[model samples]
Target: MEISKNIRESKKNILLLANKKNKGHIPSAFSIINFVYLFYENKLNINNDFILSKGHGCLALYSVLEHFNYITTEVFFSFGDFDSILGGHPHLRKNNEIKASTGSLGHGLPIAVGKALAAKINQSSKKIFCLIGDGEANEGTTWESAILADNLKLNNLICIVDNNQSQNRSIPTPNLQKKFSSFGWDVITIDGHNSNEILSVFNLNTINPLCVIMNTKKGKGIADMESNFQEWHHKGITDNLLKLYIKEIHEEAIS
Candidate 1:
């Protein structure tokens, strides 16, 4: 897929903002950009809610939100400042667009489940979508939430696992599709970088709760970052390094 110049440039801003504030889990944030890109592009915000269960990926959401005008550019660059509305994690008190305050792993999906349940009970047409990390699957609460969501038949809920394999060094979910299926949820696996695949998911049938396992590469845009993802996971880059990284990403965009 051809990368849009706006998204390409947003990559630079993400790096620059992190470089400025010295905060952000770049690789974790990069892995899920396309998912959030499609989510906002499709304007699911009209009657749906989204939760970044893996709150460390806030940079990705920030990038998308700014591009969509959900947030201003001024606030975009203010990330991690003591007075900024946006922070390292999503905060409800800071921003209305942020559906839930999330940072501690394993909490977002449970919160999403509650929202979906409320929507269902209220007979509201709103759908709840939550994005989580593969490493978060290690948390028992994540699985417990999955059990509860499926049991409740929250067909209005969708949970996406950013299956970037960053947790292989600790715990690995080799067959996330099978695991979700076993939990009685409809599951689909796809390349996370593919925009078409990401957008197509919203139309798929949902039996219980739908679980999308997006197979993504950590630090997806730049070659070196993807190659040495662990080092770039939560790294702060020097100006020279940032320039090189931006050049590499620009090269990929134009290639």
Candidate 2:
């Protein structure tokens, strides 16, 4: 419940900021917050490695970082603007806390796979986590990386797909879990909006690489936005709408 509350609150504020900044990918940002929060709070090997392959959802990562004091409030407010450390995507050079610069889609997974392989060879306990989008899974390289992860049995490596149906103007129509299963991955599917369900996916430990397919709405938690794919995906955040939405989110967060 705390994780859900954090996801809801962080997502609301991130959307408010996105609206003020006229940003895109606001819903994707909301959809991944809980996983991001959980990775930071409980799952990830923070001192080691992690990747946000779905870099459009960087707002979720940034919100968690800002919440935890990895960056300043001024930097967060200035996101997407010039000279701000927080860009629309994660950049490791800008902040040491960011494990990788991940706007390139489909690239982070292979890289994480390499790291996991290296760690396994070196007999290191460190691990790698990569969060990607279902839409981004359309990339051929992502599947190639999945095959490698499975063949090598990189159990220390974990990847999550934000299966939010819609991607770049079209919703994903294919069976995501089936695709991963065919790749020989240990696949699990769950409701992304439910914190408990998300947490359960995190509990999976396997001899092969794991791929979690999270079924999420593009714009979850916002009354006018959840699955409304048309209005809020990449629009300018109006001040009026921002205020109303924030108020609504806060009320829902506490309830």
Candidate 3:
């Protein structure tokens, strides 16, 4: 796999975090953890905000947040527990580093559009970076927000689509780059699992609202989960299965 230690750890962390309370969208988290981990690893400029719009992947966010000390290890461990701030979604953790309470699929982009517009109006140097799932693209709000962002000339807004295509069986969004370009966004597609590609794309300076379509597989790194991710989407992991996943991840990452 040639993945970074952070990626391996973050993947393992999500499993451990989910196994603790028998909760979490592990496959969803796995699909985007690398991006999230890299976002923190690079210590991305926070002049604005980063929204994990696909909030079912909270375990991935929490895992990297802990790794980067955005949230304490204690808080990370309290995931899905009684009286805990961490839940299956970020809507509950208003006090944490989270910028928006996301979970309801299509809301984050609209909110991001609002933030980027506000930044433009105030003449601030803030750039709003948002990560949305391919499935979330099925929502009208996603397209509406994109159109509005481009109309406003929101070069400060960067939207990254986690195009894992986990929802293709329902409604597939074919030619995402073409679609975003038609809406006036500068588009770039990349290998989502490749760290070098991830960093290169994120570093690019855009002249218009940008749409980065990161091609990825659901439940990446682990072959078993990657093959049948629908079953693992929100499944509670048994201890045996968890061990198997950990071992597989280690073998792949080390190979």
Candidate 4:
């Protein structure tokens, strides 16, 4: 549950920044930060490669990178502007910390597939982790890459679906684990915001490629946003609302 507290604090910060920037994608960002924290903290080998397919969730990545001292708050101040390193989507060239230039939905997995194959060819110990959105699974390219990952038997590859249960237009996420399992992936489901659960599932060494479906709330941890996916997904935080959010988050974090 402390992981949830950490997640709430990070989401609160990201939400405040997003609101100030007059930008969107806060809910999506908040939903995945716990997974990011899990990987960056213990699951992932950062010396290896990671591709976040849902690049709109860059805030999640940004927060982890900052927490790890990879980047500073000054860099995030220019977010949403054309000249900033922090953009609407993640650009790999701008930050060596990021393994892929991702923004187009459904591209991370394929790119990660290539990265995984390259590592295999080079006989490198590096593994490729791809974080994708559940809604983005609708893209045909995602499934195509899944087949390749299985056919290649890329045990070096790991895919995580952030099953936030909503995307643009606030649509419900269809059952993705069954879909991936039908494609021959060794699939497991877990609570997305629970770090311990995620770590346990990832530790399981399934010789085949693995897909961990993270069942998550769209706006996890934020009171006004958690269950109200429609309004909170991209809604800007007003000055008045931000104060209330901070106070509410403090109570939740301490309680």
Give the best candidate by lDDT: 1
Q: Against the hidden reference, what TM-scores do the models get? A: 0.95, 0.91, 0.94, 0.91
**Model 3 stretches astray by more than 4 angstroms:** 1-3
The reply for model 1, stretches above 4 Å from the true place, is 1-3, 253-255
State model 2's lDDT.
0.78
**Residue-by-residue lDDT tens digits, candidate 3, 52-123:** 899998888898888888788898888877777887789634544687899889988999899999999999
Model 4 spans > 4 angstroms off: 1-6, 43-45, 167-173, 253-255
**lDDT by residue (tens digit), candidate 1, 118-208:** 9989998788999999998888988899899988999999999999999878888778889899999998888888877887897776768
Off by over 4 Å in 2: 1-4, 168-173, 253-255
Clashes of 4: 0
Per-residue lDDT tens digits for candidate 2, residues 101-212, read 7888788898899889999999987778788888888888888998899899898888888888766476553887788888888888877767678777655778778888
Among the numbered candidates, top TM-score falls to 1
lDDT (tens digit, per residue) of candidate 4 on 136-193: 8888888999899999988888898988877646554576778888888888899886
Residue 169 lDDT (model 2): 71
